[model samples]
Target: MPDRILVPVDGSPLSKRALEVACDEYGTAEITALHVIDPTEPGYSIFGVEYDPSTAPRHGSEAWYERATELADELFEELDALADEHGVSIRTETVVGRPDREIISYATDEDVDQIIVGSHGRGEESRLLLGSVTEAVAFRAPVRVSLIR
Candidate 1:
């Protein structure tokens, strides 16, 4: 029954599966694909030197940041093509920040009817250490959220 559906994408197989679900269920609905670049991610650190907590590289930094942004744009372009094939209107964005917070904020601001997200199992230890972004979004979003395995 939702008219506008937001599906966050990061080129992961799980996220692609969520996109499949969106295409299947909301073939005629408006879909927005969002890819957020988490600046905190230590994408490339020399000598495996643990990323400094005090001075983490800004999310949108020199070379790596541009690479991430370019990748996000490419992913969205692919999604746009898929949407065109399906005759469904699609919108895509590449934001810089924490993934979950940005996604939730965008959904709230856009008034998206629902969010369909994929869960990337991080094992027990990782989940305990960092928790799950999908879980946090599910719990905090103002609108309906469907967590896809």
Candidate 2:
């Protein structure tokens, strides 16, 4: 078992399942839950709410960043509760960038021993366009990676 594990979460069911796997299988390890805010898709909705340009904050604006932060916080809260239920503790982090790049960078920089991430994220169309973040991290990460479907 790894001494440290990294789990990238995006408020998606698959991501939540991945976190559960990490907690269940590697609960004794130090786990860090990472949420990447993709700037390229500023309109990405984490809450499954339809985007309404009429009322939504403008992309790249201060309001948008604040909203993103708020959403990240909400996600962390839910993830924390899940971890608690599993009798595990996790450190949570939020970073702004492409999910794949940021996740790999964080794992390498933080000396994470393993990475557990969802096979698919919330943005299927975007994944089709930009490639799978899970695949990218699995191929590029220096440590071992486990994908939860």
Model number with the top lDDT: 2
**Candidate 2 structure, TM-score to reference:** 0.89
State model 2's lDDT.
0.86
Worst 10 residues of 1 by lDDT: 44-53
Model 1, span 1-149: residue lDDT tens: 99889998877767767777888899878888888877777642111224453465454468667666666777778777776666666778788788899999999999899999887767655644322788788889999988777
| TM of each candidate vs. truth | 0.78, 0.89
Residues 1-149, candidate 2: write the lDDT tens digits: 79999999878788899899999999999999998888888575364646677898998888888888888899899999999999999999999999899999999899999999877644655635223788899889999998786
lDDT, residue 66, candidate 1: 65
Candidate 1 whole-model C-alpha lDDT, 0 to 1: 0.76
